[model samples]
Each structure stands twice: as C-alpha cells, then as structure tokens.
Target: MDCRRSRTNDPDQWIATCPEGSKAVCEELRDLIFRWEPDLKESVNSNMLCFSQKKRVCGISGFKNHAQLTFYRGSELPDPARLFNHGQENASIHSIDLPDGLEGLNLRALRSLLHAAVKVDTEPTQPKPPAAPREEWPMPEVLAAALKKNKAAAAFYEQLKPTYQREYKVWVGMAKQPDTIARRLEETVRALAAGKKWAQRKEG
Candidate 1:
C-alpha cells in the first residue's frame, strides 16, 4: 500500500486496504481495542488506525503477513504476559505481532494489556523531570578555519546551541581521509553560511 496516501477515518476503509491474509485479524483486533474501551477516539495517522484518549494510546496496522497492535506508551505499561514481540528497543512504542490465522492468540493477555493501556491514557499525567544537558563535542580545527574564512558562517555558528555546534564538529572530525575531511569541511561551511543546521544540510 502507498503509506504516504492519507486514509479515511472510517475503520472499515482502513481495514479494506490490509492484505487479504490479515484482514480478519485486523478486524478482530479493532473490535478488541474498542470493546476494551469504547470512548477512545479513533483516527487514521500515518496510514495506521490510531486510538487516543487525552493522548494517543495505541494503533493497529496490518502488514503483508501479520497484523500489529502497537501501544504508544508501551514501555510504561506492564506486560507480564510477554505479549509484546516488537519494538523492544524503542523508548515508548512497543507492539504485538498477530500472525495470520490467529491460531494461538491469547485473548486474555491481550485484553489485559488493552485495559492497562486505557487506564494509563485516562489518568492525569505527572510532570517530567528536566532533561540532562547534552555534552558538547570539541570543535575541529578544520571547521574553525573554514568558519574563520566565512564571516556569515561564523556568525551563524556562534548563535547555534552547543548541540547544533557539536553536530558539525562530530561530522568533520569523523572523516579520517584527507579528501573526505576537505569535502565535509566545504559542505559544513556552505550549510552554516546558508543558515542550515548539520541535519538540514543538503546532499550534493
């Protein structure tokens, strides 16, 4: 399916686009999500069927071989049943892969997870602690010299936060070869001169 194309808010329309093998599984999972909590607002986001209360709770997507139920704040939810099989490394998102046929599907565990997810969404949120400062990387001599030559680049570089400055320094410093360093230095200076951050640098 063309994921970039926007899908209708209708659940049926979203289900219609799923692979034939996963159509039934998607329907069943959809029913389960609503059945567990009827008040959730359903919408299509990034081509997936997403459920939300005060915040996004979960989403469902049907792939070629399996349907997936993703909890948005899954890392914070309890999962004693080990139903989650994907996105283990993700900070907040995690999911359960429901294979075609639904042969060994654990409805009880799935329902429990859905209940917990809903409860989490309905509760008042606590204030998050302040994030620690990012350590700044040392300035590379090549970047310093290039910035010195270009007044515009130096002005922009001076105004940037340490994180943004570190991005340029790290990129230039990582270039081990002379040719690579020279190329990266040129690109960095050009981007900085154009008022672009390291991430916003255009590919040549």
Candidate 2:
C-alpha cells in the first residue's frame, strides 16, 4: 500500500490513508482507533498514520506482507503474557505484528493495550553499555551451543569478524544466572544467524 498521505476516515472517525493491499483493514483499524479515543488527534509521521494525546503516542503502518501498530511506549506495555518479542527486556522498542486480516484482535483488548502504551512514565530503559574496552575473547561454550543448535546463528558466527565474535561472548557473559545466560545466548545466536545486528531494535 502506498500510504503516502492522510484523509478523514469514516466509521472510526479517524483521518488515515489507504495503503494498497490492506486498505480495508486500514480503514477498519482507523475506525477502531477513533472508537477507542474519540478526541485524539490523527496525523501522519514516518509513513504511519499517527495518533496522539497532545503529542506523539502511536501510529499505524501498512506493508506488503503485514501491517503494524507502532506504539511509541510499547516497551512499557504490561504484556505479562509475553505477547511481544524481547519486549520489556530490551529498550523502549516494541511492536505487535498485524496479520493480513487482523482477524484475531479483540477490539476491547487492543484498546486496552493501546491505552496502556499511552500512559506516561519517566523511567529510562537500561542504558546501552558504553563501548567495550577493546579486548579479544574466546568463543564460549554458550556461543558454540548456539551455533550448533541454530543454523542462522551458526552462519552469522562464521561471517562475523573475530572482533564481533568477541563482542557476542562479552554480551552473553554479563547474564548473572546459568538459565538467564542460556536464554540470552540462544536469542543472540538466533538473532545473529538471521543477519540482525541489533535484534532489539524495531524493524519491519
């Protein structure tokens, strides 16, 4: 969908765009947003139809394969069900993937989730570590396990320069427990295997 502009939407009473394949879904979602927050202002930013409470709060975007509701404060969303990937454990970035039809979303549940994302909080996420002091480290057993278990991670490890491999080791070693260490090691390996440098960052 070429969602290049915005106009007033009907039903949900929001102003939005008609991206190609998902035009119907977009219109329905826009109406849903209006129903959820009738007084909210709607606009366009970063190619997504943005809704805000006096300032930027969230937006909806269209894509060929899927759509997404971009929650500006998604990391803080209280999704104890672990619905999102690497959500709270990472920085502020988070997202919920929309299928081609949005058939599974319960309108009330979605509204509640969106409302939680809009709530303000002053806490900054854990700060990114300062650039590591330059050093070389070995490929730990955790990394080796990751490579052995996941093909993509193994490919990534093979492609990374020695320095990058060292970086991965240092990152996994920071986990305080054997279980936590194991989980992170698994995730990092899979992320690397998929050609992702920063798996926590939001992406299409």
Candidate 3:
C-alpha cells in the first residue's frame, strides 16, 4: 500500500488497497467486529485500523504476508481459546497474527476474544506510569568550540531542547571530510545566532 495516500479516517479504504494477501481476511474480521458492536468507531492510526468505543479496544494492521489484530489492553484479556500468539512480553498489548496460507479462521474463537477485549477496555483503568525524563546529548567538540566563540549562538544553543540540540550534534558529527565538518560547524553557529533550527534555513 502507498501509505502516503492512505485515508486516516477510513479503515475500509486501507483494507481495500493494502498489498497484503491476507487483507481480504482482515476485512472479514473487521466486518464481524462492526456487526457484533454497531456503535464502535473506526479510524486509521500509525498504519493500522483502530476500533474504539470509550477507549481503544483493538487495531488491525496489514503486512506484506499477514495481518494482525492487536488488542490495546490485551494483556488483561483472558484467552480460553488461547488465540493471542504474539506481543506477550509487552505490559499493555496483545496480538494475533494471520499468516499467509492459513485456510480459515475460527470465527467463534475470534468473537470470544473480541468480546473479552472490549470487556477489559470498559473496566476501570489504573494510574499510568510517569513519563520518562529526556536525556541530554553531549555537545560535540566542534559545535562546542563554535558556540564558545559566539556568545549569542551559545545562548541560543543552550536554550534549545535536548532533541533539537541532538539534531545539530548528529548533523555536524556525520560530516566525514575536515572541510565539510568545518563548513557545517560554521553554518550551525550562523543558524543558532539567527534563532533557526538545523535544516530550517532557506536554501539560496
């Protein structure tokens, strides 16, 4: 599938145009879910068709050879049919894959899994883990020297977020030739002094 043209709001279009052979089967499964619960809303996210009511219940992703039905809160769902075969180590998600050449799916088992997953989604939620702190990237010698030479640039560089600083660091570090490195360091200082992020400068 040409992901660039994918409609983020339409799951049917995603399934219809996916290059995967198992896409037909995926469509069948999706229809079954909609039939089971008519109120469930569908949308495409991160190259997958996500279904949700109050919270995310499940998502379907189509690959070249197979398709996957991923449960957002899958780890908590019981599987008497033992349908969940992937993503077991993840704390919050569980997935079932339909590999190429699989003849047919057990509809009854799949329905049971879907209903169980929805039940989990509707249950009371727990407090989520705190977000991780961002790591600061070490300043490269070339960038540091350039910044040191220009007080305005130094202040600007210091004020940038760690992620933005890393972009400059990585750009300067990737230049192999001495002249290339020197030129990039010069440009970096000029860009910082102008309050522009790396790669944001207009080309002449």
| Candidate number that wins on TM-score, 2 or 3 | 3
TM-score order, best first, reads 1, 3, 2
Better of 1 and 2 by TM-score: 1
lDDT-based ranking: 1, 3, 2
Put down candidate 3 lDDT per residue, 1-204, tens digits, no spaces. Answer: 213434555776888876567777678768888998777889888777889988989988777788788888887877877787888877788888878423566678888888887777778764556678766656688888888889998898889987888899988888889999999888888888988888784443
For model 2, residues 146-189, the per-residue Cα lDDT tens digits are 67878877786778777666667778877779999978776786
Shift in Å, residue 50, candidate 1: 1.3
- Misplaced by over 4 Å in model 1 are 1-3, 124-204
Clashing pairs in 3: none
Note the residue pairs that clash in candidate 1: none
Clash number for each model:
0, 4, 0
Q: Of the candidates shown, which would achieve the greatest TM-score relative to the real structure?
A: 1
Model 3 stretches astray by more than 4 angstroms: 1-8, 100-104, 126-204
Q: Which ten residues in a row have the lowest lDDT in candidate 2?
A: 9-18
lDDT of 1 by residue, 1-204 (tens): 225555576767988877787788888888878888899988888778888998889998877788888998888788888988898877778988877446687788888888898888877654454678877777888888889899999999999998888889999999999999999999999999999999999944
Error of 1 at 52 (Å): 1.4
In candidate 2, stretches whose alpha carbon ends up further than 4 angstroms from where it belongs are 1-17, 81-90, 121-204
